[model samples]
Target chain A: MARKLLLEHAQVPGINTYEVYRKHGGYRSVEKALKTMSPDEVVDEVKKSGLRGRGGAGFPTGMKWSFLAKPEGVPRYLVCNADESEPGTFKDRYLMEKIPHLLVEGMITSSYALGANTSYIYIRGEYSWILFILEKAIAEAYANGWLGKNIQGSGYDLDLYVNIGGGAYICGEETALIESLEGKRGNPRIKPPFPAVKGLWQCPTVVNNVETIAAVVPIVNDGGEEYAKIGIGKSTGTKLISASGNINKPGVYEIEMNISVEEFIYSDEWCGGIKNGKKLKACVPGGSSVPILPHFLVCKTANGDTRMMTYESLADGGFATGSMLGSGGFIVYDEDQCIVRNTWNFARFYAHESCGQCSPCREGTGWMEKVLHRLEHGGGKMSDIDLLVDVAKKIEGNTICPLGDAAAWPVSAAIRHFREEFEWHVNDPKAAMERNYGLVNEKVNA
Target chain B: MPKVTIDGQTIEVAEGTTILNAARQIGGELVPPAMCYYSTLKGSGGKCRTCLVRVTKGSEKDPRPMPKLVASCQTMVMDGMEVASKSDPSVVDARAAVTEFLLINHPLDCPICDQAGECHLQDLAFEHGKSNTRYEFERRTFEKIDIGPYIKLHMTRCIMCFRCVFTAQQLCPERVHGIIHRGDHAEISTFIEKSIDSEFSGNVIDVCPVGALTDRTFRFKSRVWFLNPMDAHRDCPTCSGKAVVWMYGGEIYRVTARKDKYGEVHDFICNTCRFHTKEKGSWTIEGPRDLDRHSVISQNHYEHGEKTVR
Candidate 1:
């Protein structure tokens, strides 16, 4: 079995409670980090861990931490992004719901490293029940001398609070989260004054994802080098993947990053192959935003190498044949699935979720959704296929936020990999209306 | 001051000046169209992608072409910066795409609309948009909302530029209206149907780039082309005491905030100056000067030589 860092003790009885979590060596990283290591040393250890963010962007977590500006007398903040609104991504929710103290322990260690006295967990509003679980765990941490001021005679003071977002997917963006935290609408702010420089009430802030902050516990406890030794190459340490869609086991699974994609999908230990023993058609390896790969490309790279679930391996072909390990949202599509309908569904989600700040995202997302809806329902033209590509290209890099690109990638990838399926929908309107274009036995376009 | 070259023309701009402002300062058809950016309003721009320009070379401080097209309104000009606005085909294509997005859901009721002649979206579409549209699907529509006594919101015309929302938040001491809902359905709405009854509520009508938010008093009163705008001022205790009165025939039709040559409102006039102080006895009316070159009204009327309205 893969070494499960987060969900190792998830199935233990009463693990959600503070007592059980503490009994199972939960906050040991906090003790090690606060008592033994200085803030700089903790940061250096995290840098050595090679831990990239588990969020969709996959930014280097330690590098993001070192960029936090420590102006004299200014209260720097450490915001944990628990707003797991990305489609097919529920790993953060699973971690928090099953083992809330892991996040609490990680937040304390990360806050101590960044010299942040005040920390907040910005959770999505739909996860309201999870908030109570986290709050109870935080209270337990306070009672156990982990969160309060001058803990263990360390002369370090830290306070952690939970802020519930009004359920905006854009709030997952750090600046937008900061805006929402400050009691404003969730519109993403412009860059250059990044959150590392000026954020959250004009103070320097470091916003890390729930999984990124949670990984710090293991990094500090086992030593960064030890954690780095587990996974292959730059993808060090175990990652929690929320596996769903056409899978027998549709739940969060913790796996070492060195596993091959085929092994993770077919082996009994992981996804256990497609549901009902059906043939694989396409798979969105990361999240919905990443490019959808046909079954052949999902198992192997465009370079004919066996594809691994690591960041470098998954993104080897760079949006042409390969997809990202974004938020570890591993969604599998069986032969029965329709690419046009699925792409239209994703477009609709984006059009509904867009903050309407940028014209490309606000206007273009709606246009793509309408176009895709027309194509899916037999009301499409031959020119509309290229028009979808054109619209997606226009929206890709034009908006202020990544939501534009996220809304574009799925449609472009669908058309790139499965243009024939779209043509099938357009050419035979009566047949297309009756049934989906099932899996083709032919090789991928690449 | 940092020297930047835009469209083969080089000019030095003050520190912290945006590329859009610099291009406007350089003049001669290089100025990028900005739909959401207001020089007077803070925290505008970046929402509208109409001002996107390719930065070929970064400043002396940072020598790297920006990875993608950046919003020129938000990007500060740096030393040795090279920007391609109207001269670049790619930039022009991007602006055209933005225009298409802006017009995809627009009601396009130019005939009956009060802002028909003086709309920025209309002018941008004429310059940047394709002759025909590719969007064959149903265009989005919204119910007309009377947000307040003075404002009538035809949300179908809103392109979600957020200019009015920012204007309301910044100018009104008590802000009640803001953008609500999400994506294409997102519209500027008053909280709990509360009337946008602020002292400077009518400034939203002025900041609106389209006819989404129109002054109820001036709705369908007269086309903007027929009205001759005259510089007018009043000694009101509430505001800056400056405005432009749009007069048709012998009576004043509407009064709006006076914009400078760069199309920036000199002051965000209150409702009293914008709506209540339109009477002929309120201020000293000066002879109608030629329309400021940067104003949207001027761009619409530029084809016709300056006609003396008096």
Candidate 2:
């Protein structure tokens, strides 16, 4: 298979090394961008390529770049929002760890394009090993004159720094990320002056996800129109999805944007179908934040359209059936697994990460957590099931950021698709408890 | 500027102004529920379904909007857009449903809630919500997790507004408060197990739309309907965020946040006001010249004719 942008050198073993990366055509984009393409040309090329952010939002990357405040030469910043705290989304870690130079090269090129002399990679703190790898890789780039001033004597100056996050999901929000970078707590700023306008240090900034920036390297090398032709319709590009949970081969797979859900799941080239030959019960097509699709509905959607990976196709019918390609965190559920319990896990994650800024998200998350915990562990009543659905609906689209909606989607989706699971827990507490604890033990053993 | 008609009143507002704000800009006959929006903070948190309004006229494609009751907090103002807040059936139904749903798990501890007087829950309940819940189940409960010294928990009374979380972002520089879980099972929790240790942790108590979150020091001291908030400021070494300490029986019982004064000029309080800002009535009435700071003047110097410690 002719691997496109993401998988071009993805199969190359030990590409983490600078020499191996160089051999596989890395750092060429930075050299090309600085020595040849003007910053404006780079932006125009990206605009033409129609490259959207891979960080869940699917915002147009070039449009986001165009939003920058260019007041005739004020310092702009290029911040790589590597705070990949989104649950089930682990594509960036593989890319950054496998080819650290790829990110650095991407950052250098993107920074130059955004008119930024300084850049910072904000990595989530859990990746200590990745942190060390990046630090060393950055040192290598510095030594090779690729990161520091006058790289390859092109007279393009750029500096990069890595900021360690205190482990916050809110920091992933651009403005909140800027606040954390400014040495404050990771809380989202009220937007009006989005980061592109008055970001990091009150200067114009462009915050791109790790995968988003890395994608830029390829966009520049291959012509924009050529890159655009790979994917179907508006979903123009390959996506690296973190396919975990109940799958035979639970791994990150980079598939064309138009690949079907069935192909992505059952194809040996991707998830390799359900584990232990289990029946598919349901699937959270995107990240935990997107709505969960029931096996019946998902199959219907998949059967009706064998090509449904793009933003438009995946969300073709909105919440009624479709799910979002948020951060490409694809989690599948087998028939035996309880949807309520699975949703509770996601609820627990969001409640933990909520920055406690707003009441609905803060208070509602807690309320939902307690209710879900009760329902899952066996103390819940029938009305509790209704209450859970009600609370989930209340929390959805109600808070400051998508966090509220993120919290709401899984609960609402779980109840909508599998209220029977929660009813089983509430109606037959002992059996549900037995099932839940069994899964917990199974998880531990696995 | 866009010419928008809110209710029956025709008005003009700056472009990009949300429909809710536009209605608020020009006094409208239709009462739109703008519960989650705080115009002070640039367009946010349309979580509360209260600000929902029906765009009954103008614009053919959206003559009948999908949501039917769109959150006016999110929908920006458009030219010739007509909003039906009071008369709209869908808006009323959505609001009533939202309020009832919000109040289902919320405890009946409002009599003792510090936010009872100024709470959106209380106002919305009487105005838009059903008087009683059909839910015949045990309300969702948390064991009143003590997040920090500054903030208290009463999980039974929460309504899940993002105001506290948003307030933490703006008023407090640090991340002391945030949501912990997802969906109906989500909870507002501190980072890891650490306390909500922030300079502006008290604002969380104030911004908590409901009593789910409360001030620990003032718990059970005074109900919101009773204690008159005496306007005051703290001369604490760190923050000057106006500390409107609550007083009862001529004695200050709680040193809570004064929301009116939180702005660019002042209201940036730190740990000093949060922890050490005690009631002035608690003072011993003695100078620190002769003895220690807490030393009180003796009755010998307290005579009507006698001079006090100077």
Candidate 2 lDDT for residue A380: 87
DockQ of each: 0.81, 0.11
Docking class of 1: high
In candidate 2, which residue ranges exceed 4 Å CA deviation?
A: A2-4, A7-14, A299-303, A439-446, B1-4, B12-124, B133-310
Q: What level of docking quality does candidate 2 show?
A: incorrect
lDDT of 2 by residue, B137-211 (tens): 577688778887767777667666666667777776776677665444457777775786666676666556667
Instruction: Show pairs that collide, candidate 1.
Output: none
Best candidate according to TM-score: 1
TM-score for each candidate, following the candidate numbering: 0.95, 0.74
CA RMSD (A), model 2: 10.5
